[model samples]
Target: MSKERSSRILHGFISACLVAAVAAFIILAIPDHLGRAGIGAGSATKKNFPSAKNLSSIVDLEKEKQAAEVKIENPSGQLAYFKPEQVPIPPGQDAQAQDLTLTDPNQSPDVAGGSGAAVDDSSFGNAVPIEPEPTETFQGVPDNFVPVAEDTPRGSSITLVTYPRSSLAIHEPPAHVLRRSKKEYSWIFTPPELEKDVAFWKAIYSRYDKNQVVLHHPIYLDIIYDVVDLGYIEGDMRLSELEKQHKKEKLIEEKRERIVSILEMLAQNQRLSSSLNDEEWRIKKLFDNVGDPKKFQRAAEEFGVRAQIGQRDKFIAGLKYSGRYLGEIERIYEESGMPRELSRLIFVESMFNLKAKSSVGASGIWQFMPQTGKLYLRMNKIVDERNDPIAATHASIKLLRHNYNELGTWPLAINAYNAGRGRLKQAVQTLGTKDIAKIVKNFKHRAYGFASRNFFPEYLAALEVAENPEKYFGPISYDDPLRFEMVRTAYHISLPSVAGVSGIPLEELLELNPGFSSKVISGDQLIPIAYPIKVPEGKGSIFIAAAARAPKSQRGSIRHVVAPNETVNSIAWMYGIDPTRIRQANANIRRNPSKGEIIVIPFD
Candidate 1:
């Protein structure tokens, strides 16, 4: 063959070879492309499969599809389909789990074929095992899984599932530890030896009303002869006050006479048991411990019947009012290292009455007489700290501490608060015993009356009632604690001026600072310099600032000499002030001021 013909044959053969190679490449690539498109049935190669990132997204999509197919079996054993979002997240999972679309990988279409043929997952390695769904029923979901309301929309109603309460763990904050007291006063205050007397006083304070009078022996308080109902006497408004008083005295005297008669009859007749009345039998039962035949006579003569006025209403009132100052009083006693229970003695003395005053010059809630009060309290024409609850509390603490120091026992010290300290000391010396129970039983002095003898027991009873008021008087709505800030006067200032400066009502200032006398409250006199006065809470600094800004001339009393014919109205008109202001400034002044007498005109 020629060289050109040979070359042409070689080129045709080369073209045929290239065409055959391209056909083989097309045949190989078509299978891979079809396999990747999931069209033909063949195991997908590692390269044909998705990348790691794409594989994650595919798994998530498969999971969401499988989750939609999964059904939760409630307590009724009925399969219920819930949205993946509606499913409660398991306890160990975070809040992000609420948004997660969960599914069973074993049921995923990617891992298992929809035609029920298992796909080989050896390339992806072993699959993660799914946890079993929780089957616990919740509070609102019933065991039978009935719909809550007939009107509830079908398939729209959701039944909440929760873990059993027993399986739930609750975490509480640790409790704060408090300081324990070193000493206890229970035995000293509520001694078993004096329980009978204390109980008697407790009955008087709680069980009986103001109209009831308990008649009992002076020494043996448990020996209650009778309880006289004086309610009838009180209800008789038609009777004059004098007539009512006389009628009550007569009734009490008649009862006394009858009791004496019974005792005398019992003493004279040994065979009186057959005809004895119900009251006589009760009285006879009380004397069963006595061995002497003439005991009735001795009792009639020595065991004089004493009457105690019931204080239940007063006690209840005291309890309600006590809330205002109880916290502060307790704090004061605690700070002084004294028995805080002693502060309840005010309930016994004056029933927490701030305006309490005794006929014998005793005053305030503490009942401090003039002689005793003068030592620790400030009492003068311009101010009386005795009427001030806070100031009086301090004074009472000092006096009580002093008494305790001198008397060496709380019983004697408390008694000294009512009776004179000298008298209690004398009784201790005479009795030759410091035991209050023994002193109460045997020691008898003419001066140491029923009140002095029963003082300690009354205190114990008051303490018990005050501590547990709900037991005596059911549920009390107490006054809120007094809120104020104490400030000392920088200068002698009138109350009206203080009110003007601090922007507090004049009446409120007067109420808070009860230590200020009428003269001080009015413009007749000025609040003394350095004297502590109570202002509304958070107003102390404001008062100080305002007082500093006030002119010196307007701060103190503005006095005027009365002309010969000057009346209160005329003097008020002359000063261009109110007549009422003049009267308030000069409380002692009546309709007219005496000639040449000094009168005060209130200045704003």
Candidate 2:
């Protein structure tokens, strides 16, 4: 009896549950929302307007269901029409009107809809006022179930993504080499053309350690695009203090190199003055500390062929410079009452360098001081005979003449060439009080600056070496000879014209006339000219006659205008005059030519 009572109670409970479920189903079958997606809104569907012809009695249990139920055997069709909330969206199929609500937007187009069958919208007809079914609640896990700990990687930490699609992200533990520096690096790419490289990058990259290097593009290429994109993701790279300092040092180094390279090129081109230092060019040390000819000779040798060997043509031609001129220095010196060997001083003072100048305004082979030059030689602002090789040599010869007369000794005459007569007199006077050898021995105690200190030695060395270079040093060949003479040109005659008339090249003319920076010079300046070894030996008159062959346009209307401190004979020699003719031109030619004396000459 107790068991029957218990069974009855169970039946009553089941019946009560059945009744409640029926009522809930009826409520769910009613139209719930006003719009389309399956939420708070109701939407239109086939259930809302099913065919009236197929209307069946509500008493037919299966027919009393909501829309989407299909006919089949057993129970008339299907699994519980997936509740709109549980609809799997059929992957590609969209929601129908009854399966969804319309009021809400942002609905997934694939969500299926749901509704009841054949309901009419009316207040009094057969329309039923349907209330929305409450959404089914999600049941959570049972409290009685035991939970297990989740597995995780050893070093992994989790981060929940806060984006729309929340996901689990991991924050990896630090790497093996933890970077202590805050410094960041950036690379700048250069366009291939803009970069002037000697393939340095290619060479560096070729040997670069593959494991150590990051950028490894083979062959030369521009990676400008890649560098640009990095800027967007990381802004600018931040440098640490150490990195900034390193960059500063690198910049300084590059600037220093550029300055050095520029200066080096300038010096190499000889455009920059290095008059004081020669080692900068990698020349010999002997040439660097230069004051005498030995060092200059080394420089000449280093310059090699272009200076000496290549100059052979001109040096050989030096012997051919004849024009009724006194090219015989030896004979001339013998006549000047001086040692014939004194002529060799020309080679030392210059390399027979027709044009040589000193700092204190000495010029020509025998360098002279300006004040001293003024006392013995003639010089003017408008004229510096000091620059004329022949005239200066003549003056030198005269100076030596006076010294030879006084000293009565050859060495003293040569010494007097360097040490002036007045200074020699002072030296002799001082020598009376002291030993001459002792006085002149240590050159460091010499007067008259650098010139006096080395002057006598240069002359002596030049003389001894010229006579017996084979004995003292080694065999040496004297340069061919001084091969040039002066020829007069019509006033304002261009060098180009003289080159045209004389059949001598323009360059040859300029070389022979190094003193003429321009075509113009002193009023009676003799235009330098060169002739072959053979010219009529005694045709001074004929040569003067031939010089007159220049066109009238090239000649000055007036003949010769002599200036102050110039003798008629001096002017005549300047015009390549005959000494007899000069004496005939003016019995007093030794005196200055009067202000205006128009002397006639043969002119074509």
> Largest lDDT belongs to which candidate?
1
What lDDT would candidate 2 get against the real structure?
A: 0.35
lDDT of candidate 1 over 1-604, digit per residue (tens):
6999999999999999999999998878887777666566655532343322111122332343344333655442323333323332322345564333222111111110111111111011111112212321111211222111221212211221111110001111111112334244433456677889999999999999888878776767788888889889988989998998888888887887777777777777765686898988888787776687777887788765677878999998887787777666665566567766678789988998988989997877888776666556555444566777666777778778888898888888888888778888888899887787777666778888888888888998987777667778877767666665444433445666646534567787777766666666665555533334566654444444333333321233356655454566544433223467668777778775676677655443
What is the C-alpha lDDT profile of model 2 across 1-604, one tens digit per residue?
9999999999999999999999997667554432223344434422243221111111122321233122222221111111112222222235663133121111212111111111111011111111212221112212222211111111111111111110001111111113322221000122233232213222222222211212211111121001111122222258665765566455444543443443344334454445534433432231333354443333223322110011222222221231112234443444455544466566545545556776666676556556555443334322344555544555677677778688754445666777666676676675563232333443333364444533444444443333333343333333333333222222323344333333344565455434343323322332322111111212111222223332211332124444444454344333332335545544444444454544432111
Q: Candidate 1: global Cα-lDDT?
A: 0.60
- Models 1 onward score TM values of 0.57, 0.35
Which residue pairs in model 1 clash with each other? Answer: none
Off by over 4 Å in 1: 1-183, 236-250, 290-295, 485-491, 494-507, 521-524, 535-604
